[model samples]
Target: MNETIGNIKSRRSIRAFKQEQIKDEELQLILEAGLYAPSAHNQQSWHFTVIQNKEILDDLNESSKEAGKIFNDKYIQQLSNNEKFHTFYHAPTAVIISGKKDSLMPFADCAAATQNMLVAAQSIGIGSCWIGLVSLVFNGEKAKKYQDKLGIPEGYQPYHAVALGYKKVKSTKAFARKENTVNYIR
Candidate 1:
């Protein structure tokens, strides 16, 4: 298989990460890949907020878990109650992906960008995890405060996040695929 295909097949969600920060240049390459992701109507309405500060990450984690405590989903509530669970898995760097509120297909656009970043990180031997749980905090009572503090555009809504750092343990094997999930029209 080609390198791209190999990378795609091998990429896994890394839950454990080293405390060391990834190089700024590597982070840039990952973000650049996100910037290159396709968007609907060429509307690249995504914004990335990179946070390396431990204090902020801790605060966000705590807030997200607190918000998750009352979530309608039982799984989320359980995660919230589990003191061992961290939304970002304690990665040294966390990026919040936001989308413009008025843009068409903002969620999809941001999602594409997020995937691009993930693939790019994998290709470059970096560890990454897509962090959807962080949204609980952004959607909660302190949303406005975080939006302002994170410098998210006034008209944008935070959608997803990715936690990035050096890997504590590298993952080379892909999980087994579910059979018959794809169909070809041809």
Candidate 2:
């Protein structure tokens, strides 16, 4: 397989991460890969808020869980109620990806960037998890509070987050993929 395809196939959502922080150079490369992702009309509407502070990560985790408690999904509520569930899985670094509210296809653009970051991190021997639960913190009355704290721009809405750190246990295998999910034209 091609190197890029191999990297993509090897990427996994790692939850258990070591306490040691990833190097600044590695982080920069990951962020740059995100920046290089294709965007709709080249709008490049995504904004990244990198948070390395343990206190803030913990606060975001708790706040998101608090918001999830009242969510309509039972699974989310259960996760919220679980005392041991950390939104970011206690990763040493978290990057909040936000998109301009009025941009065309901001969500898609941000998602592409997020996927790019994840693949880049995996290629560099780092662990990464794409976190959607953290977006709950921006859905409640405390939205403005966190927006200010996270320094998200005035016109942007946070879409998701990526948790980054070294893996506590290396994952060596990919789970079996479902069959017949693809279609082809004759």
Query: Pick by TM-score: which candidate is best?
Result: 2
Q: How many residue pairs clash per model? A: 0, 0
Per-residue lDDT over 48-139 for candidate 1, one digit per residue giving the tens place of the 0 to 100 score: 99999999999999999999999899999998999999889999999899999899999999999999999999999999999988887778
TM-score of 1: 0.96
Error of 1 at 27 (Å): 0.4
Per-residue lDDT for 58 in model 2? Answer: 96
Off by over 4 Å in 1: none
Candidate 1 positional error at 55, Å: 0.3
lDDT of 2 by residue, 1-186 (tens): 888898899999999999999999999999999999999999999999999999999999999999999988999999999999999999999999999989999999999999999999989999999999888878789999999988999999999899999999787699999999999999
lDDT, candidate 1, at 84: 98
**Candidate 2 structure lDDT:** 0.94
CA RMSD of each candidate after superposition? 1.1, 0.9
